[model samples]
Target: MNKILLSVLLIFCGTSVFSQDTLLTILEEELEREFKVLSKAEVPVYYMDYRVEDETALTITSSFGSLMDESNARMRVLQPTLRVGNYKLDNTRELANYYGGGYFGANQAQYLPINNNSKAIKQVLWRVTDFAYNNAKERFQEVKNSDIKNEIDDFSKEKPTKYYEPPALGSLDESYWKNTAKKLSAQFLGDSKIISGTVTISGSFSRKYFVSSEGASVVQNFNFIQVFVSGEVVNEDGEIASLYNSYTASNEKGLPSFDTLMAETKSLVENLQKLKEAPFAEPYTGPAILHPRVSAVFFHEIFGHRIEGHRLKSEQDGQTFKEKVGSQILPDFISIYSDPTLKNVEGIELSGNYKVDDQGIESRRVEIVKNGKLQNFLMSRSPIEQFSNSNGHGRSQIGADPVARQSNLIIETTSNISDDKLRKQLIEECKKQNKPYGYYFEDVTGGFTQTSRYATNAFNIMPTLVYRVYADGRPDELVKGVDLIGTPLAMFAEIMQAGKSIDVFNGICGAESGNIPVSAVAPAILVRRIETQKKPIVDIKAEEPILASPLLNKKN
Candidate 1:
């Protein structure tokens, strides 16, 4: 979500003159001749950087109306980011009493020369920067023979940034997204209890570049386009119902109309045949509403990986708000904030809109919970305890290594009300907790959380539209399989009210620095109790399908 304009791409050039761009003058002349011979060896490196990227893609898939695949790609990767011992202590810190010192010993995302040659891209950036400075001098000699004595700071001294953005190219058509995935997978071949009707369609384009020995010269450009649509069904209690819906854009005229993706793929094949005739949900607890895209994946996996400031100096993580900064944590009329320089909000599009971070800093806006106290945390040049630097949300993916993740989070609230008064306060908190039906959830395909210390700080989510809401006024049923579990300070101490319409989700977000792109934004709320379970049945009877679909043949 970048594709130009960081003040018109940093007003053209001059972050140390990027030497008329021959791949940033051979990556800043091999990062100043390999930092003058690694600044004279012996655990010296201090810091370094390089990043690369390039990318470029296009994909398409379809199912019921055929065309299974189509692709076109391009590559270039790289990554290199080394730091030995300094920035207050390095080897990328967090060895916690040294458990075999790893610090990227096998570095990753190498391959680079999608041809801008300069001696084959400085010989694969001088052999991955001499294997990332001999794995940062063997993890800085195990953090200088650790008898473990640490006081924060394994790097946070920012001040090197010189931006630029020139090389830009992104164009897709590829037969109009392969006929828009065969016209939305031929509308799931008119049902026949649709067992799998797909449609994919992708588009990427990266660019990146970067460089530094602490002189940082950047370049950026991103662009995405997505449109997915899925369906799968089984029903009659053999239980296997799936449903999907996606659409992100930063181009392709900001995506949407194709009759609005064929009316959301015919409402995702009529919600996969009403989730194969609903009814499965059992383990409940009480009152709920969620749905501002399922509370934006329930506050991105229950409160965005517990405020990532390198997981409060990981002693195996679970640092859930490390001493809750200013306490509260939710419901003073809620607040949250993340903003990777927000690209779009009221109009959607935000796969974490970046304009720098992957550690050349830049992006900002991090408030992390406001009215409900708690305050700041998503930093990145790693350094916790009253946060040190990086509000840029470092990020990763393309060979992992930057962290402080979550990007466009958002949240807000301020006592809003009305989605019919948050569903009449979720049936008046299920008739004041005597609960006779309450849930809602509606739409989600992402969820996962356990902030470490070896799991179970809890969170599950995984709902793909749920429902219930009764309390004697009947109607509103459609349930299935369960799951939306809890425990993020007991689900932010049972929210209680929000609504006034807002939404958005966007995708991709693995962790420990891997699958990037993210976004959240919320609104619908109501909680008051929340909890659920039952959702594990996975046998797929050896993936059923004993012949039928020749477009559901009764002789076609």
Candidate 2:
């Protein structure tokens, strides 16, 4: 009978004209029928999420000769959740703590079981609904009737919105995938010889369907494409050093051009070769200039993570800036903002733009810091005491709960100092401090930070290309084996100046739940006083006897 009703609704709506209203109507009718069976127990809240993903990948790997691997796959996932908190215990402790603390309990479980068959996709909705209903009932039965009534009354305060419908999946095909792969590969290969390198191109198109018992339904689609190129050179000491570049786009046209990527790859290879003989430096602290890319890492690891709303809620967190709000945390010339609605910056497309967040709320721009003063915190539905509404910053991986997460972080500076001036200033500062040389961080890999109160609140900014600028006006020397480390508050206070040029760093960030693509943009920055620690050196001995093969041939 349910199948018959769904089929009838589909036929009535037609494939091309199936709007959000039509989908919601169908879901409402189905939910009403299911609710009749739960007359003995009241349903407090329920939600459903359905997602379909189509993926294609092409990979080239080199052990001796390059081997190609390609795959095309699609998958659909369905999740339904129901909450019944109305069942209350007569115990005073249970009545006092309503949200998961009392005798009234809340539980959630995934309805979709692991399956290899095609029929698994079709069973998602039915299975999830059944599971949620059953799970809610079991919990409701444990509580007293009076407590159940009180919990239901509390849950009734907020009403869910109308159904939401996402944009349609226009078209997708193999040709589109192949062409994109070809373009990305050609860009990275350029005129260089086929040295030891690998290229991987992958893309996904995801469609989502969401429904709730409170008359809310939504369907949306998201598209993603990524291309990655990696190459490595082993030093005489058997230290394997590698470089990688990745490009992500919502559509094919937004990706970097072939020429641009080829140039980057060539440059990466050259840098790796240079690093083969680079010497490590002893730990020191004086003056340092962080290039735009390095500055992005500094900001993301140091500042961005510290501002998440969940961290503020945890008493264990340092809450570095909680009391410092309305005070100057950064230089007057610096301004930072995070906006999910921004599709581009300085004509470059941003990967963080999205119409709605994971929790079905519209995305908005969050002014994290305005002209050096702390402004607001990224918020999810979990409101802190001082913050009441959601700014739609909540995000998470599929099947994970959402929390306040960063989007596109833009660090703006009003200073007009150039790269040369920044270096000159660093040298002057080194002279004043009676130091032999200062540091310049030209490039970086990503970094991490610990914001909890248990440990010293500090961050380590890893540098790929670091230099020592002598106070005697001698040539800048390339050095390795030092990481930029400092306390956030002290570092912020020591920010001496910023440069005019800006650079963008794009990559994936891994946290509690999973990894997500994030971008950071900033200009070169100068800090008066910073510290570094010696990176632990590996004791691997160099492999003996260079191969006499032509693959070892060096360029003139």
Candidate 3:
């Protein structure tokens, strides 16, 4: 009886200790197991990352029954990934050479068949380890048969010390988000005279714990808030005009005040009224000035996308800056950089702030162009021949593969020219070119670019608000129906000057994988020459007006 009791006590004590281990501790133990397996298998190169992400979100939406629908949700995901390369069985030179080439790999979802408990995470890890070992073994055999020696030798280069700790959790308050929506809605209805509308405010907080077999352990936290307000207006022409304003922030205090947002909405309504009277512009090629907001779109669509490292390696990409490294790409007065470390610009917290990138690399600034000279390209873990390591720009949405992406792009100008001076110079250039007027792009909606080498290598920058600055000192004319179009190389060559005052634009950019928040800070820029094509317009005949709701019409 005594011997049985002692055995039972020992078993119970061991179980309790294992159960009490923190999630981080358990994750480390799993990594150790993976390392041991790799050594036993004699894999030449291997990498394994185990991560657990805990996410909480509060969302509010518009509904008929309930003016606002508010709900909270929490979820956790365990992701374990593994890669193996260069396995050789024999000492033969040819076999060794064949195994040296880098291995191509794919990610497999490790499902936990067990219930949603902490121990389930361990099961997920086990699944990934088993899959990776089996896959590597199969791939090694294939490499031996191919006898591709030179390629295998190239795969053994190990890069070093690019890891970064995760950022701290910023402040977040659910009440604040809820109240912001309520306040913005009330202001729009009461002050802006918006008849019907909807507002959605959402907050997301995520915590990620990562452990790798290469002795890397990190924990990161992030919080974000987004507010969206949309409204509709029926004009005198019986056409409905819709306006949307969105706000995003990593820190709560950085969001605009309720009154400020209300004022902007009121102005937006006023602009929609003017848009009804705005005339469509004819296609013209002339000197133009892109205001900061418009200029941001220009840089992002034309320049930023082309410099992503992955695009350069693809045979389809134009590789605009590849051969222009030592040459000037922009005017001598302008310099451009993309940095993720910057959290704020002129007191506003930018949305792109993150401590570590998706690939566990530390975020760093990449200066693509300095003083008009082509410099460097944004990099991620996937190495190209020229660029080997990540500059902390690798990013992706949840469940998507991380890739090289832009963060906060800053365009700095060395010139001391004022906005008015830039416009005046544009008019002079127009006169010199014998054109009646130049264009001033005041604001933008968004734009797209084509980076493929097979195509025309052009970009279309859509402008929402544009004006013609007459060379003969005529009144500025508001016009629509124009889209800024040009090639990257030609556009960069035409940059004449930049303005003194800086403007900041915050928004999200959608690419192949997903949408990610980004910001652009720049001053108004003057380009001596640019090209534009007329946007296609609809020629709809007159139709009956869609009446407003009875309740709203009665109030009006």
Clashing pairs in 1: 443-465
> How many steric overlaps are in each model, in order?
1, 6, 8
Candidate 3 TM-score, C-alpha based: 0.81
Index of the highest-TM-score prediction:
3
> What's the residue-level lDDT of 108 in candidate 3?
47
| Cα shift from native, residue 50, model 2 (Å) | 6.0
Best by lDDT: 1
lDDT of 3 at 15: 36
Worst 10 contiguous positions by lDDT, candidate 3: 1-10
TM-score-best of 1 and 2: 2
lDDT of 1 by residue, 151-204 (tens): 877777777767787767677788878887898888888666676888888888
Per-model lDDT: 0.80, 0.64, 0.68
What digit string (tens of lDDT, one per residue) describes model 3 on residues 372-477?
8978888766555556556777676655556778889888989858988998899899999999999999887788898776678899988767889998888998
Candidate 2: list runs displaced more than 4 Å: 1-43, 46-65, 86-122, 129-196, 538-546, 549-556
Ranking, TM-score, top scorer first: 3, 2, 1
Cα deviation at 449, candidate 1, in Å, is 16
Q: List model 2 lDDT by residue over 1-556, tens digit each.
A: 0110010011233434444344334444555555545434554443333322222233332222233566655554444445554312222213323432222212232434334333443345455666656655565554444343332122221133332444554333445445544544443342123334666666666665555554444455666667677765556556655556777777767777767766786677667666667777898978889999899889999999888776665556788877766788998899999988888877766766765666555567888888899888877654454565567676765655556788788999889799889988998999999999999898887788888777889898878778888999898888766778998988898899999998777777887634666778899999999899987666864454444445455651
| Best-to-worst ranking by lDDT | 1, 3, 2
Better of 1 and 2 by lDDT: 1
